[model samples]
Target: MRIITGIYKGRHFDIPRTFKARPTTDFAKENIFNVLNGYIDLEDAIALDLFSGTGSISLELVSRGCQSVISVEADRDHHAFIKQCLKKLGTDRCIALRGDVFRFIKSCHQQFDFIFADPPYALPELPTLPKLILERGLLKPNGIFVFEHGKNNSFEDVPGFIEHRAYGSVNFSIFSNREPEGEDE
Candidate 1:
């Protein structure tokens, strides 16, 4: 996978064949960032990347100028690879952690300006993720959350639902704690 833009733009990382994680496609990644660019500023924003397969999203977050990024991946190999990548990049902006995403969510008390989760689509707990993260107060008042899932899931009816975007088979549901414009009391 390769970063689409920012300081690390044009850099590429090779994924091992034995890995089971599905790194977000370049097409989907590019398009999602395009959509995000219209809504929030990445510069100086503290971000979190859960289910951080290959650490692609975390690296991208740092590339785009996020003040800091925390990447959580469960697999030992994947976690090591992420650390290796960070070292190669000579960047201290991202922290790679090895652990279960759900457990991390339940224990995390700090809020972030931007959060992204790209859990396995087939994972049974997929549906509950948005609610779990949002309910835990993981997002600051104006923070944005982007959850990546398969086409089978829909979050339009959920609270904080901003909009949904699709790129081929990839789907992203965006949410924010702040009310949409013109809805303020």
Candidate 2:
């Protein structure tokens, strides 16, 4: 995987053949960051990356200047690889956690300015992730949450849905904590 821009721009990490995680493609990752750039500032923002495969997004977050990032991955080897990557980058901004993403969400009491999730597309619980995270109060007011899934899933009808973007087979559904403008309480 390669970081497309920011401090770590052009840096690449080789994923082991034994790994099962699918790191976001450079094309998709770049485009998503471009979309996010228009919505929020990563500078000093606190971020969360759930199902953080290869810690690709987490590393990119730090490279772009997020003050802190928490990366949660259920796979032990993936978690270890993420830590190794962070260490190689000499950055302490990202904390790699080896645990269940759902459990972490349920137990997390801290809010974040940005949150990203890239769970396995075939996972049965993929559809419920957005609602679960939003309902848990994980995002600070106006904060954005980007969930990546396959093209077969759609989140436009979901509450808090802001927009959806598709890059090849990868799909991203963005949500925000604040209600849309012009709506009465």
Candidate 3:
């Protein structure tokens, strides 16, 4: 996969066949970023990428000039590949961690301007990720959490859901920090 825009535009990485990630399609990624462009300044943003699979999203964020990105992946090989990719890309802005995404969220004292999660499609617990993130307070005030899932999944009924964007088989359910009902929680 390659970065489709920004400073690293046109740079490509050959993901080994052993890698199990289904990297976001360039078309989808570009479209998503275009939509985001109107709202956020990448250089002013801090991001978190859960299940960082191939590190593609993190790299794209860096390429687009995010202030920092914490990218977490549990697979040993995937973690190694991400590390190697970061080194080759000269990216010190990304913090790569080898750990369970859920556990990381629970333990983190940090909050991100944007968080992207792309869990395996077969994982039955995907629906609960947004709730988990909220319980752990992983997002900054007004931050966004974008979960990428398969066509069959739907998060529209979820609390804090702001929008659902689709590009063919890829679906992004976006949740923002909910406005507290009373007393500011």
Pairs that collide, model 2: none
lDDT (Cα atoms) of all candidates against the true structure: 0.95, 0.94, 0.87
Residues 1-185 of candidate 1 have per-residue lDDT tens digits of 89889999989999999988889999999999999998899999999999999999999999999999999999999999999899989999999999999999999999999999999999999999999999999999889999999999999988999999999999999999985568657
Q: Residue 66 error for model 3, in Å?
A: 0.9
> Alpha carbon lDDT of residue 51, candidate 3?
94
lDDT leader: 1
Pairs of residues clashing in candidate 1: none
Best-to-worst ranking by lDDT: 1, 2, 3
Instruction: Give a tens-digit lDDT track for model 2, residues 1-185.
Output: 98877898888899999999989998999999999998899999999999998999999999999999999999999999999999999999999999999999999999999999999999999999999999999999989999999999998888889999999988999999875578777
lDDT of 3 by residue, 1-185 (tens): 89887788888989999777889898888888887776566785999999999999999999988899999999999899889888988879999999998789878999888898999989888878888887688888878788899999888887778888899888888888855657844
Show model 3 residue runs off by greater than 4 Å: 178-185
Rank order (by TM-score, best first): 1, 2, 3
